[model samples]
Target: MFREVPVLPVVVPVAAAVFLILLWYLHSRDRLSAPRAAVALALCVYAAGVVANTVFPIFLDKPARSALWKVYLVPFANYEVGDAVTNILVFVPIGVLVPLLVAKAPWWRVVAVAAAFSLVIELTQLVTRNLLGGGHVADVNDLIFNTAGGALGFGLCSALSRVPAAAALIDRFRWR
Candidate 1:
């Protein structure tokens, strides 16, 4: 049950302010340009969307459930295609953008960062479920599929980077 409360009315404005401030800071410091700012904004929006989707809609009433949080440690157990695909797609942008944004990001580093990001999200869900009524559970399959998606995106980025025209276009938007 991944139900989220209708709190975006407040969250969106706050997130927008934060994103604007960050973009301003980076631009003032000569670390960002118009195109780079656009890229940064896209990354910020994607990250916010992921967090919102995974961690919101808490169960404040604490319905007679045994525990406030739950985890599925069994990998690939009763895996659903929709869930797996969603998890993978959610992480694919991280894989593509990290390498594009960082000057020295290798494929392994991309994968590692994706896994760490997924771990942080899962841990947050665990804590938030207990403290704030979040209903999402940590699942090993999610972690696995998220990493796989990142890997796939990295491969796609790598291949695209090898193409002269594609590389030129990517370099145009690349921050580093």
Candidate 2:
């Protein structure tokens, strides 16, 4: 009964969007709300997935190690550290855009939204690994760091969203 989970983090959000769209199409009288929700949910999921994927491996007791050591090659590079750092750097955008993209998100509400997004990702990882025969172990650190990142991103977006220069820049970019 072990199902396989895809390695790519984006799959969860993409799948969610598809699922939401299908559900809305089948049951909803209002067509617009479904698509709107689908986009919002997908973005939230994507942001969470990015955070979870990046931060979880950092706190493992038996961290993912250098393959070179096993292969009898150079043993200096710690692969796990590299991977963790890369994950943090990679998810920086998720932290920023998810908040701004969210409609009418008040400053106080952003934290809750970020936390909710992080929770979904962590839970998904835990459930997927446990029920799907994957070796992944969910860690609490991932939840914390990911949520922090998302919160930071949200704050940055909120600050910039109000600035006239940033708005002008965005408009210029969108025009091109």
Candidate 3:
């Protein structure tokens, strides 16, 4: 039951953000476009939702981790397939969106941002579990996987942007 957290809770907000961004692109003419703002807004909201869902309970009175804490440094040492994949999948959009929204930014900067984001999540898990006593265990593997996910996302989006058709489509939105 614990592992069955609904994916919709996370995906719905992001999907909505994407839709709004498309709309904003269609109607706006300011230098600051919708896609860029949407990416920032979506990233913040998504990060918050992730931390809240993973560590804190939805209801005010619900129980949390509470005295149970663990950490895994060894990659795949105690792997749970679903959790690992889900972690990577969740961050992939950030990877893709960051580069797309900040097209002029260097690749290293995009990667650094992604890594920093993952690092924050891991640290949050550690701090909340130890100090507040309710959060998932912090794991280095998550950092690795999440970083890789971000990189992959950047790669995929970047490649797509190079394609003539994709480039034309993306250019219409004026993401840069």
Candidate 4:
């Protein structure tokens, strides 16, 4: 799965975001010196890159509609383990980063953020298909898998927040 996943989409944005965060911390008068904020911002930007790569036709260099709306709500229909897993994994960072960035937000807020972001991506694909003439299928399966990935990320972060050492580390990342 790791080998099959493209690294550039995640890496490029993350690197740029981190560099920007470091610069912001160094130059800005604001006290946003939390390492966690930097990480969260980088992750969110990386997640956006992943979504933009997956949904938009910007990479294709042509205006041609190659996608149909995939309305299937069922799982495992024409599913490859790699693609299904990748689809979920792509959004996992969003799941982890959003909750980390927002202080004291309830767990459900993670789900809401994940769902809203996923829906926006899907809707973008749907709209661009008609307007730009080239985009991904706005599939329900992608939304479900992406939301599941986000929930999983939230669970992992929540569990880590319970650990003494991890909590201490998380605190170091906190904006305040």
TM-score of 3: 0.68
The total number of steric clashes, by the backbone 3 Å criterion, in model 1 comes to: 4
lDDT tens digits by residue: candidate 2, 85-171: 543454455555545344466655666665666567656656544443335545555555555665666667767767998966533
TM-score (all chains, Cα) for each model: 0.86, 0.50, 0.68, 0.71
Clashing pairs in 1: 4-57, 58-133, 58-134, 59-133
Which ten-residue region of model 3 has the weakest summed lDDT?
56-65
Off by more than 4 A, model 1: 1-6, 59-69
Q: How many clashing residue pairs appear in each of the predictions shown?
A: 4, 1, 0, 0
**Positional deviation of residue 5's Cα in model 4 after best superposition, in angstroms:** 23
What are the runs in model 2 whose C-alpha is more than 4 Å off? 1-91, 169-176
Using lDDT as the measure, which candidate wins?
A: 1
Report how far off residue 148 is in candidate 2 (Å).
0.7
| 1-176 per-residue lDDT for model 1 (tens digits) | 54445657645776788779868877787777776777778877887788778877665555434553578899889999999998888888988989867887999999999999999989888777766667777888889999988998898899999999999988876766
Task: Give candidate 1's TM-score.
Answer: 0.86
Clashing pairs in 3: none
What are the runs in model 3 whose C-alpha is more than 4 Å off?
Answer: 1-29, 33-41, 58-69, 172-175
Model 4 TM-score on a 0 to 1 scale? 0.71
Ranking by TM-score: 1, 4, 3, 2
